[model samples]
Target: MSHTLDTYRLLGRSGLRVSPLALGAATFGTEWGWGAEQDEARKLFDLYVERGGNFIDTAGTYTNGTSERLLGRFARDRRESLVLATKYTTLRRPGDPNSGGPHRKSLFASVEASLRQLNTDYLDLLYLHVWDFTTPVEEILRGMDDLVRQGKVLYVAISNAPAWQVSRMQAIADLRGWSPLVALEIEYNLIERAGERDLIPMAREMGLGVIPYSPLAGGVLTGKYSRADLTATPTGTDDGTRKRFNLGVGAVTARALEIAEVVKEVATELGRTPAQVGLAWTLRNPGVTAPIIGARTPAQLEDNLGALEVDFTARQLARLDEAGAIRLGFPHDMLASDRMRAETRGDLKIEARQ
Candidate 1:
């Protein structure tokens, strides 16, 4: 079924309602070297909020903090009606060792900075931006719970962390009566389905809504890059900055190009743009609560918002899945094997419990 921007969904086990497509503020400022300036960013913001979009996502350190500053200004009037989500843990200063991490100090300091930058006394949602693998889970959970108790943060979430670690943290929160993580953000798209093996499933079982970032695979699924562009040198312009970033992160490889071909084919079949097709594919996942749309321009934002109207036929979805499938390694593959299934069921017509 097709949804609108106002078709709100419950975020994980929480009662908070959020739009299916979140408005990402990562591209809200030109400080990143490739993003919309203040006026353009405001236009993007207005376009989204006018369309009944209420989930606005950003980070305290995004675009060197310009993103949050701009959002704070634009959202000043309607902040109460919007679910403003920002993250912590990315370094706020270059040389400060305590400026980042999931520890208590970093958590409190980052929340304070974010509240100030966002021009708000309380944050609707706060996420641990990255997992440093050094801080104890207890420290992170306790700190987040403390913020919730203090009313500095309403909800806590995580991003870019291992699946096992997230699950463990959730279990700890339940045991300790802390504020549970309501969302999980990860780089997920047709070209990057590694999250499917564990992260997606983990979120489903642990009650964390999976919010995918880079749902377009850094524009690789937009059908803009050709095989010839793979070898072209990246320049310093805004467009070149994206290409350079994509190349540096290995986003525009031969395999990714193959996946883009399938996406374009599906988009053609559906009379939609490749960007819409790609974003729609992410929305189809039952485990996914929302996919962050990082469009830098009003036109791009409008195109991305069309993803809500896209519905894929079974055949089209299967083709897209085949083009970018990943190996679910180890126990997942082993358990799904026919022989293992037969051994477990003994040829009985077993109906799996939903």
Candidate 2:
């Protein structure tokens, strides 16, 4: 099925423009076990490009580099046709000690390995993947700038880093004339509003493209396993199949069911599925540059890609907002207080209506 997405947007703070939805190759091969076969992986890549997807994300540690190698083989013929983004800083070996870190040596080595596996001379964008307090800001910045200079990476980005630290890196990079971050890969969704505290604002201010990894929140937001869902029982998390693995969220569990019920209603009204409703809700967020959809099969990818057709009216969005809404907390909560609003409006003679 063809998609309506045509023009691409510039990657966060960078000159690279990519499709609104990117294909995540974390499930490309079974380096970590439980992944698509190589032939199936190739088909998935072809289908994504067929649907106009132009951005791809992978990592060195994903399936112990199986994902990157598979993507490299699949894209070698069409490398210039897509915007490829991969990450470093995740450990694959247990006792290597220097296998993964934000340090210059690790970054350099990781890129070299990734390049060999990816069969590419340069990356469109490279992310640090996570923060490591062991490395100083200057060292990290200079190291990444060196990669850009060496033509190993076209742009530098950070993922899962604190707002202050991200800001400091930017400050250091700017002062020293090093490369700036162009994107932020974060765990963000409607049910998880924690990023709003600082990450969201910082990304908006710094012009970083926000690529939400799990827009479906490990199927939590998809409403697939709720009691009343009438869908397949959720895949077992016993063998560590669950992301956020085992946090034991009764509140989230209950809320997700409630949200599932609401989603069923909305989906019925719109003639769509509950999953479609959830994905569409995430798409309505203006701050998100794209949602990385992970699929183990062509059929699964089809289901997610179909979500682009699901649109929400103002009233529909308001309902889902109430269902999956998370408390902003702290200053955000204080600012939302009616008393504060009333006080601020008093100077304009906008007193309480009562």
Best by lDDT: 1
Total backbone collisions for each predicted model:
0, 1
| TM-score against truth, every candidate | 0.97, 0.88
Off by over 4 Å in 2: 1-3, 227-252, 336-354
Question: Model 2: clashing residue pairs?
Answer: 12-209
TM for candidate 2 is 0.88
lDDT score of residue 211 within candidate 1: 95
Error of 2 at 165 (Å): 1.3
lDDT, residue 104, candidate 2: 84
Tens-digit lDDT string for candidate 2 (70-162): 999989888987788999888757788788888888899999999999999999889999897778888888999999999899999999999
> Each prediction's Cα lDDT score?
0.92, 0.79
| Candidate 1: segments with Cα more than 4 A from true spot | 235-241, 348-350
| RMSD of each candidate relative to the true structure | 1.3, 4.7
lDDT of 2 at 105: 80
Using TM-score as the measure, which candidate wins? 1
